[model samples]
Target: MKQRIAWITDSTAVVPDELREKYDIHVVPLDVIFEDGAYADGIQLSSSELYEKIDHSKTVPKTSQPAIGKFVELYEQLAEDYDCAIAIHLSSQLSGTYNTSKSAAAMSEFPVEFVDSQIVSYPITTLLLKGISLAEQGMDYREIAATLREEASKNENYIVIGKLSQLHKGGRLSNAQLIVGTLLQIKPIFCIRNGVVELFEKVRTEGKAFRRIMDQLDLARGIHKISQVEILHGNVMDKALELKETIKSKYQDIEVLVYPLSPVLGVHGGQGTIALTWTNEPKSS
Candidate 1:
């Protein structure tokens, strides 16, 4: 008999609704806490709504991982029908969601395998979609999980920060650095390395930062074959579309997709932030 596997991911992953429905991928949401109360990311509050609230409020919101009990309940329900589950989440370095999921999985009656994507946003979406394809090709649950973990390492991510205040508030930047960066109009390009977000480069302007991103993409293409690229933004569709057009003009064969960053991510990135991400073509196993 074939083993039945359930696909699970957190709200930070950007799986399309149709794809999620077709693959039966389950998503657990994180919470975004405002001054008044906490709202589940993508549940009670959307990315637009989150931005709107931030615009009106004096304080920036904070995000929290889902409760362990929530995962336990989900596992309990899945235990009835599935043989095992694969839960892919954002980087452990970035959020505690993966660790919380692990604890919940341990308490559940069902077996659960976890993939710490070591990344976030559309890259997580890419990993989950790739795992589903691997499973469809007759790979077992364990093989699929292992494959996803390996693929997670190949994801290349870069972000252009839109607001310096948010990073300072989040403790990613110091008071001195913030003041200098603000004074200089420095737009930093950040990348995920070894599961932690690191400053890749600092350019004097946003336009210069974008040029650096394009240059990075050129270098990546020279080294590896990239099939698809995703441009994610925090309520900045116009800029995302402009970047999409530029990429398309340069690489006609590569597919490009644009998506809104989840509210959980927006809280950290702030409005007008743009993220560019892609995975090198998977090597034959």
Candidate 2:
């Protein structure tokens, strides 16, 4: 008999509602905490609402991973139907969601395979989509999990910080760096390296920063065949659309998508921030 597998991911992964419904993909939401209280990332607080709150508030919000009990409850429920589950989450270095899910899986009677995507946003979406396709092709749960773990490292992202103060508040930047960057009007470009966000370069203006990102894309194309490009923004749809158009004009063969970043991500990236994420085609052994 074919093994029944359940697909699970965190809200940080941008799985469209229709696709999630079609694949029966389950999503566990993270918490976005404001001064007053905490709200579920995509459920209790929409991205637009979160941004609106940020605009009117004096303090930036923080994010928290889902409780281990929540995952345990989910696993117990899935155990009734599915033979096993594959849980994919954002980087372990970035969030405690992966560790929380692992602990929950260990306590449950059901079998759960976890994939630490080592990245976030659209790249995680691409990995989940690929895993779904692999499962549809008759791959077992273990094979699909292993394939996703390997493919996870082949993705890359470049984020352009919109507000320097937000990074400083998140503890990603020092006060000295923030003060200097603010004085110099520097736009810092960051990338995920070894599962942690790191500064890639600093430019004087957003225009120059975008150019640098495109240049990196060009170099990446030479090294690996890119499958998809996603432009994610924090309440900046116009800029994301423009960047999408530019990428489409250059790489007509590659698929491109544009959408708002989740509220949890927006809390860190801040309003007006934009990111470019792409996945490379897997290499043959």
Candidate 3:
């Protein structure tokens, strides 16, 4: 009999449900808490429901990583049937999920290989799906983890925010800064580096921000292999689809996925947030 590998990731990953089901991937959800109550992401709270609450709530919703106990419970269960499990999670710099996952792996009786994707949403989901494919092809856990780490190093996440108020309310930005930026209608463009958010540019108008993001994609197209592309949005599906069409017009061969940003992320990203992510083709000397 062939040994089975259990694939796992957090809810922050933007992998589609159908793919998750097909891959037999286990997703441990994070919590999105409102004044009324706390709800498990994707389980009790959906992106649409959570956004509706965000639209009307007096206070902004907060996100929390799953407890260590939850991970322990999952690892124990996976140990029952699978030979081992590989658990990939969001960046440690972005959240404590990677650390929490590591702690749980230590507590598990069976092997649970933990990885810090150093990226979020669609980029992380891309790595998870790739790893799952490798696992299904009979690759060992360590080999799959190593390959993903290498790929993640060459990946990029470019996010464009429609507003900075959510970042302020979430404490990612200071109130004064938010006021200044919003008063001026600033569209913030940022990228993830080494698992931390780094500002790439700040433009005055939405048009410039989108153009800048596309320019970066163009530059990436010049230098990388361009294996995958993802279009992520908080609530702006129309705009996301438009961007997808633009990308398709330029790069017709690459695999493209349109994913909705999770509610946990929407709390800080706010509505109209759109992100583009892709992995670079490995460079050869």
What is the Å distance of residue 238 in model 2 from its true position?
0.3
Worst 10 residues of 1 by lDDT: 276-285
Model 3: per-residue Cα lDDT over 15-117, one tens digit each: 6779878888898999999999899988899888887887788778889999999999988888888998888888889889889888888887678777788
Q: For candidate 3, give the lDDT of residue 76.
A: 87
| Number of the top-ranking candidate, with lDDT as the measure | 1
Q: Candidate 3, which segments miss by more than 4 Å at Cα?
A: 171-176, 283-285
> Lowest lDDT 10-mer window, candidate 2?
276-285
Give candidate 1 misplaced runs (Cα > 4 Å). Answer: 168-179, 282-285
- Cα RMSD (Å) between model 2 and the true structure? 1.8
**Residue-wise C-alpha lDDT for candidate 2, range 4-93, written one tens digit per residue:** 899899999898989888999999999999999999989999989998898777778889999999999999999999999999999999
> Candidate 3 lDDT (Cα, whole model)?
0.85
The TM-score values for the models, in the order shown, are 0.95, 0.95, 0.94
